[model samples]
Target chain A: MPKVTIDGHEIEVSQGTTIMQATKQLAIEVPYYCWHPGLSVAGNCRMCLVDVEGPPKPQIACYTQVTEGMVVHTQSEKAKKARKGTLEFLLSNHPLDCPVCDQAGECDLQNFYMDHGQYDSRFDEQKHKKKKAQPVGENVMLDQERCVLCSRCVRFCDEITGTGELGIVNRGSHEEITVFPGKEVNNAYSGNVVDICPVGALTDRDFRFKCRVWYLSSQDSVCPGCSQGCNIRIDSNLSRPQHGEGERVMRLKPRENLNVNDYWMCDEGRYNYNFIDRNRIQTASRVKEGVVEEILFEDAVDSLASVLGDAVREQRHGRIGVLVSTQLTNEDLFFVKKFFKTNLGMDAVESRFSFPEGSSDDFLIKADKSPNTAGAQALEVIASGTYQSGEDLIDKTIAGEFDVLISFGVDIDGLLGKEKLDAILEKVTLLAYVGSNHNETSKKAQLVIPSTVYAEKDGTFTNVHGRVQRIWPAFPPLGQARPEWQIICDLSEKTGFSVSADDAESIFSEITQTVSSFQGLSYEKLGKEGSLLSTVKETVEK
Target chain B: MEIPEELKKKWDEAVARYEEKRAALLPVLRLSQDHFGYISAEVEEAVAHYMGTTPVHIREVVTFYELFHTKPVGKNNIQFCHTLACNLNGCEPLIKQLKEKIGIKEGETSSDGKYSFSRAECLGACEMAPMMKINKDIYGPLDKDKLNEIIENL
Candidate 1:
């Protein structure tokens, strides 16, 4: 350990920790742009300049390693002057487009100008111009005139993705970041360049002019796109409904979790939140005599209870099948398992929903598309070696083994093709579909109940690595939709189970008491990063 | 583009000098620039393929250095010194004379494709003052007639 004093604050750090990393522990903010903790230090952006007691000139904090008993003054006159000069050089050619720039509220250049630089402009020459609004990739747009030449995006493409699609093309004042003449920056994680860009140079095409960042509220959540369970922040404008016709989710940003996806997420997980607002089941409905009619939430719950009660009274538990989805949270799965086993005495509960073949990389992506398949296994919702695959489930349904089928968050069209799904739907008597979206399964089902998406609920998901992470609600549930756990609890009460838990936190505590895999974990204990269960399997496969 | 077998052997020999393949990028680029008239996109891609890197990395290096040209040049490429020492020693008159006599500006090639001219920074011949180089040959400390005679002989 080396003891370093930064701005009169003393702290001991590891041998090779940089001055920027040490100053972070003392709550000293050193403005930077090109120095990302996740990427190699370029040290080209001189905004992190700090005065050292022994060094002859000011050094960039990102590249200078802290020595034992070294003294550093980050707010001294020399350091401040150096930072101001760096800011002046950066802004000398930067166009004044803050009012129209998407990164105005969160840009580092705008922030450092107010913090370290307050001088008048000294540049009287005509500002250099380059390409504007160039489409570089499928999801990223580039404005070359607004770039600060940080090389963050270029380094990101080269180092992180191992796809060197970007580079500084010219020299000196003519230097501009661009791709090769005919090639484009198309990759699995190309949208991350837009997130790593500290200025308005790169902007996301999906969220370009959607909404200003100041009007949106953010909440920490886990991406349900895959089993990697990358941590993310969901930004939504819940109050302002007049923006884009009830589309609440403005964008999804990567939340830094060093153990998980550290400061970076794949484009699939980053842009997967659009389904939360599009093609959603806003209200409950039921099919009556070949005509679909919207029904009340209480009526839908009562109708489902009557079907379960009739099956229990007639000793027909073997005919009642409940098909759950791995997309449901751990708390939702736990409640569904307990209700099916203890209340209805149903032994046909299974999770036969298979996700489509999603692309995977050596990085954060996983071949398993479900976010909580491990949690489903841990809670015994899908029993080991007894659960049927998606095709087998469709075969079993067409054979008339299960007269009453209950599904949650499982897209039937995706599992089996439309022909097979339609064949299975014709044989089932009472089909109750509970999901977030209006898919083929919900359209043909006799009963359709809307369930809240992951962004509108608070729960935990056990990833492929068996690391549990918590998701906080960024906004209220749309229409009459409710969390699956709450809906399950209400239905259980209607069926005379009396689970008595109305909220996710209480049900999570009950789950911790009963489930051995979640024995010692509680909602409060599983902080934003979440705790890993002690009993993770050696090798997890789907 | 396919590099010649001799140049490919030279590139391999150059690559063998460095421990890491990425370190051989500059020398390999120089070799390609010498063999070809200039480093084109195809040449950059070929070098990147040979060095196990990307074309953007090769492009970054070629654009950063002043010696490597990315576009095609004439048979005789003339580089005029434009540093403070050369400017104070009457390099401006030589530049003007070349521009008028060659019927082309600093970065333009001649109509017959025999000559091309460009202004360059210091060539490390400050003692020779107003110096210029053409095809690996440096001539300096000369008047207009001496430069005209050299051009006429060429």
Candidate 2:
């Protein structure tokens, strides 16, 4: 180990650690643009210049390694001058389009300029021009006039995904980032370039000019698009509903979690968050005779409990079928198991209702689209270990095996066409749906209850690798929607099997007690990056 | 684009001379420019494919140097030195004279495809200052009559 002092703070690091890494240990701020921890060092962006005791001039902190008894000063006058000069040259060609730029608030260039910039402009020359608003990929927009040529996006494509689609063409003042003449950057992780670009050069096409980032509030959550369980921060528009056409969620940014997705996520998960606010079932409703009447959530749950409680009390467990979707979180799944399987002893309870598999790669996207298949499997709710049992549930319902049926977040029409779903609706006397989004199943169910999506609830999800991670809500449930566990608890009390846990944390504690895989785990222990299941931990230790 | 057998042999020798394939990019580009009149986009793509790299990477190198022309050159390619040595030796007046006679400026070719004009950094002949190269021949230290006579015969 080598001991180095950075700005009067001393720390010991490994032999090959850089000065920037040492500054990070001491909580010293060294501004940078091209030095991403996940990407290789380009050393072109001179924003991280720092003064060393031995070097004649300021050295770049990102590439200069520390030695024994080395003294470095990140806030020295020489280092500050170097940084000011670098920023001045970088902004010499920058078109001051801050008022219309989408990355005005969260851009590092703007943030660093406010912290360490020399405000007065010495440049009176006309700024160089390049192409603007070029769609480089399906989800990424490129503005060449604002680029500082850090080469982070070019290096990201070259080293990370191994898809060398971007490069800096020409030289000097005429240089700009571009793909081939006719080709485009259409990789599986293309949206991440917009996240890694330090300036407004690359912006998300889906989120461009939708709403200003300062008006949006963010919360940590997990992406429910697949079993990969990539950690994310959900940004919602709470104050202004007129910005994104009355949409609540503004965007989803990938949170750094080394255990799961590191710092990158697939485009499939990044752009699939509109379902949280679009086409949602705003209020509970019941189908009376042939027309649907809007009702309160209390009336819908009470009427459902009366019919299901009667069926279970008459020893007609064989006639009641409960189909749960794997999209429910672990806390939600635990309550579902407690109310339906434990109290009623229903034999036809299934959670692995199948849907169409999505396109996957060896990187982040998973073939199983649901985020909590492993959670359902760990709780012993999904018996077959496969997500292809929706056909079986539909077949049983069509054959008149069950007089009552309830499902959560399952689209039966999408799984087996509208004809089979119509058949099940005709046979079952009472078809109830407890989900967030509106679909054919929600439209046809006799009783419909609105529930919160993953972004609007606090819970944990066990990923495909058996790591249980936590998710916090970005906002309250939309309109009159409630968390699924709260709905289940209300139904349990009305059905003569009342449970005690009220919040998501207490319900997860109950899960840790009952499920063998989730033993000795709590929300405090799960933290941001999750904890692997006990069974997985034992196997990994071996 | 099919590379000729002799050019492929030269490319193999160039790759073997360097430890890495990409280190041989300059020599390979030079060979392509000598065989083909100018390095077009097709030739750049062919050279990049032969070197196991990308066309954008090759395009960056092609645009950096003044000698590597990207478009087809004329029958006579004329280059006038424009660095400190030539500027001190009264090369600007001679260059201006040639530009008016050629009916084109720097970085432009003649309309009849008979002449092309450009400014070079240094030709490594500072002793023969105020020099200009035309079709692999160098002429310098001349008066206005000698310069006009040389172009008139061509």
Query: Which candidate number maximizes DockQ?
Result: 1
- What would the per-residue lDDT of candidate 1 be over residues A1-44, giving only the tens digit for each residue? 99999989999999999999998888899999999988999999
lDDT (C-alpha, whole model) for all candidates: 0.87, 0.88
What's model 2's interface RMSD, roughly to a tenth of an angstrom?
A: 1.4
Best by lDDT: 2
lDDT of 2 by residue, A116-185 (tens): 8947998888888899999998999999998989999888888878787788987788889988777788
The DockQ-based CAPRI class assigned to model 2 is: medium
Model 2 agreement with the true structure over B27-134: per-residue lDDT tens digits: 999899889988998898899789877777788788887778899898899998888898898889988999999889898999899999999989988888888899
> What is the DockQ score of candidate 1, to 2 decimals?
0.78
Residue B106 shift from truth in candidate 1, angstroms: 1.8
Q: Going through the candidates in order, what is chain B's TM-score?
A: 0.95, 0.88
lDDT of 2 at A89: 87
**In candidate 1, which residue ranges exceed 4 Å CA deviation?**
A354-356, A383-391, A537-542
Structure candidate 1, residue pairs in collision:
none
